[model samples]
Target: MELEQDLMVSERKKKPFRWHVLVFLAPAVIVYTMIMILPLAETLRFSFFQRDTITQAISFVGLENYIKLFFDPYWVEPFLNSLWNNCYFFLIHMLVQNPIGILIAALLSMVHLPGKKLYRIAIFMPTLLSFVVVGFVWKLMLSPLWGVSKGLMKSVGVGSWYLPFLGKEETALTTLSLISVWQFIGIPMMLIYAALLSIPDEVIEAAECDGVTGISQFFKIKLVLILPTIGIISILTFVGNFNAFDLIYTTQGPLAGPNFSTDLLGTILYRTFYGQQLQPGDPNMGAAIATVMFFIILTGVAIYLFFIQRKLTRYEM
Candidate 1:
């Protein structure tokens, strides 16, 4: 027994302490906790308290803010409208952007395609442009007077088709959504393109040997293999669209003008937090809205992880 105990102690001592791992990870861990975790916790804490409108005193109000948010028409109306717009924005991307990306990726993946590198760069270049630049450029291009869009339409012999899309409430949100799709479509295209390229040559050869070729083979094999990538892109789109603010704010201002037709949750949060012309800024309400946004993003990611991700089969190459 004594001999066995000694041997066990010797074995335990042989395992060296890995201080290097901790040293490498400490900076990132500390940074993340400070930047992300602490702020998130503070936001949640603020949501449950309220400040007196006149006295400027804060007091615990529990779920009163949430209740007011849901039941008060002043808050509820804009919140619902923004939420719906956000969903519509996400839907447009899912329907239009991703399908187009897949088609482009398919074409780009073709063997011996000419100017393939140039085409990829051209498509992706817009994504690197700042949102301020993109918004300003598009706003100018869509200007009713002396804008290239109008002139281009006339040149194409479809002069009647041109409208001030950004000026009209009905078309503003849709136009912006399409513009966003144009800028970021390259992301999905590149991701899907890489997934396609990663498929082993042996698999292609085997498929050809078995008489599987062309469009039919892509639908059956390549598409199936990249389902996991598609799922990831969908989740990314959800998170990004839900958090979208910059372009809308730049183009339409904090009012999200034309009767708030282009308002989104991010805009709502901004307006509520910062106050507008007549409205006083409500930090507690702003924090509540932010907390709700966090939960919404969390719920979406959780659904993807617990439900969607599990079902996607990542076939080994």
Candidate 2:
């Protein structure tokens, strides 16, 4: 009995560490913690502090930066404008990108479609191109002076309809939003395509048995099944749009020009953090803006997790 008890105790105490799991996770955890987490935490911490412009001294000032961001006329006007522009950008992507993606995905999912791989490659190829390249190319293409877009429009009997889209305040943001949509639409297409393909053969066969076919079948069955994926795509679009800086910066410069018509939160943040031509860099204010962005993204993610995800019922495959 004593020997058995001792053996049992020894066995219980002999806990082996899962070294393999730690080994696999260590690299990713270390990298993420070092890069993402540390930077984010530092930004948040910095936001609560203030810097003296004249004396060049830093001091703790809880919420003053945020208060100024919300209230000060110097900051509030551009902030609101950028916020609205960001929303418009996101709305365009949601309306144009996702639907087109779904349509393309549905078409590609068709069994008898020829050269599906070729079509997929063509649609997705632009996504792999650098943003700088895309922006520069699009800028040249849209240039009213000598752009091929103008020639193409004239070829299609619409030469008079061509406008300098990127040069006008009214059209700049919308035009850039459309350009962004064109670049990233393939993401939603591929994701929705995968989701559509993942729908079991059994479910599809059952749907067909009930005289459901063609567009009716797609709307009734496939669309319903891919709601979760669409939701995911929507959230991703929101995050990406809010975080957007590269293409806008590459195309419109730090001012997000056409009279700041194309300004977004990201562009504003960059300008604030790094300083524009006349304005000096303010790290504290930049950190505060970044914190706001973080919360905005967090709120969106939280909504999706707590409300949207709960509502979206995942059908078991």
Candidate 1 lDDT tens digits, 135-167: 888988998976699889999999898999998
Candidate 2 residue-wise lDDT, 135-217, digit = tens: 99999999987769999999999999889999999999999999998999899999999999999999999989999999999
Q: Rate the local accuracy (lDDT) of all candidates.
A: 0.93, 0.95
TM-scores vs. true structure, each candidate:
0.95, 0.95
- As a whole number from 0 to 100, the lDDT of residue 31 in candidate 1 is 100
Candidate 2 structure, TM-score to reference? 0.95
Which 10-residue window of candidate 1 scores lowest in summed lDDT? 110-119
- Predicted structure 1: lDDT: 0.93
Candidate 1 regions exceeding 4 Å error are: 1-8, 13-19
Q: Which ten residues in a row have the lowest lDDT in candidate 2?
A: 110-119
Q: Candidate 1: how many backbone clashes? A: 0
CA RMSD, predictions in order? 2.0, 2.0
